[model samples]
Target: MTNSRGGKRERLASAAARVLHEQGVEKTTLADIARAADVPVGNVYYYFKTKDQLVEAAIDAQDSDLRTMIEALEAMPDPRERLKTMVGGWVDQRDLAARYGCPTGTLAAELDKRADGLDERIGAVIRTFLDWMERQFKEMGRDDARELAVALLAAYQGISVLTNALRDPELMVMEGRRLTAWLDTL
Candidate 1:
């Protein structure tokens, strides 16, 4: 419902996304999201019937953010430059990734263990990105666009895990530069 502060559902979903990313799905509670959103815990039920539903909303929130980012990148004139900037943007998150691992990756890994279909929803987010990357590669006339997209995203995710394990943001930066350089040659 709309309030003086804005839509409570949106706020709760946003807060749930942040809390879920920071705390992981198992560790996050609806009350925690309500607290973060500054909404009464009871009010959360009006928006989400259960924590799983809230998690689903948070997943949608994450998807929305990713789609928005893709839209921004779509504005770039060059597909190659768009790809480079995407890597750069990810590299910029190295510090946070080091602290909590990649947000999308963390959520996907954590949620995959669930019996419900939440994991598939999160997987769709990754596929969304992969599809976007593949489109960009295809735009650049790469016949192996899908494979290249997978390789690039896989590399980024691998470095994200290592960056967190090693607590070294530089690892992500170095890999980003390396990936961008490799992109320049294509």
Candidate 2:
């Protein structure tokens, strides 16, 4: 029963992610998520005590997939190739932002007015992701991989914003390849 409940919550969380990504955090309500998930409005409360909790869960759901990707990178012993593979996945999949507009950025931009620790949670997730990326860079002989990781992350975030605004998925892959090419030169 616990596992089943957890599955239901996951389904709810995924539905919340879709709603939040499509409508932005401010516009996403429990009702919206409930409708999207095909679950009752009260069911949302059962899974998530508050809107913030729902948002956090949704963000967590998005990162769950990302964490898998990070693990995949860790499996690749070579840093450069790992970084390439990881970033390449994002660049190659242009609809990422269209489906979910950079969860970190979306959370950061929305949670600006939220309670104090809310932003911290988002920050922590992003930091973990960047740190993982930097680890790969460090393995590639770039002692200052942290800085490079930050730059690469920024580029990806900026690309997501631009792609979402312009509805151009191709630019993501183009810029990703361009960024990787530049990294190769370095």
The residue-by-residue lDDT of candidate 2 on 28-104, one tens digit each, is: 88999988888888877888889888888887876787798888777876777887787788776678675666766
Off by over 4 Å in 2: 98-100
- What is the overall TM-score of model 2 with all chains considered together? 0.90
Off by over 4 Å in 1: 1-6
49-159 in candidate 1: lDDT tens per residue? 999999998999999999999999999999999999999998999999898888889899999888589999999999999999999999999999999999999999999
User: What TM-score does model 1 achieve against the real structure?
Assistant: 0.96
- Best by the TM-score measure: 1
Steric overlap count per candidate: 0, 0
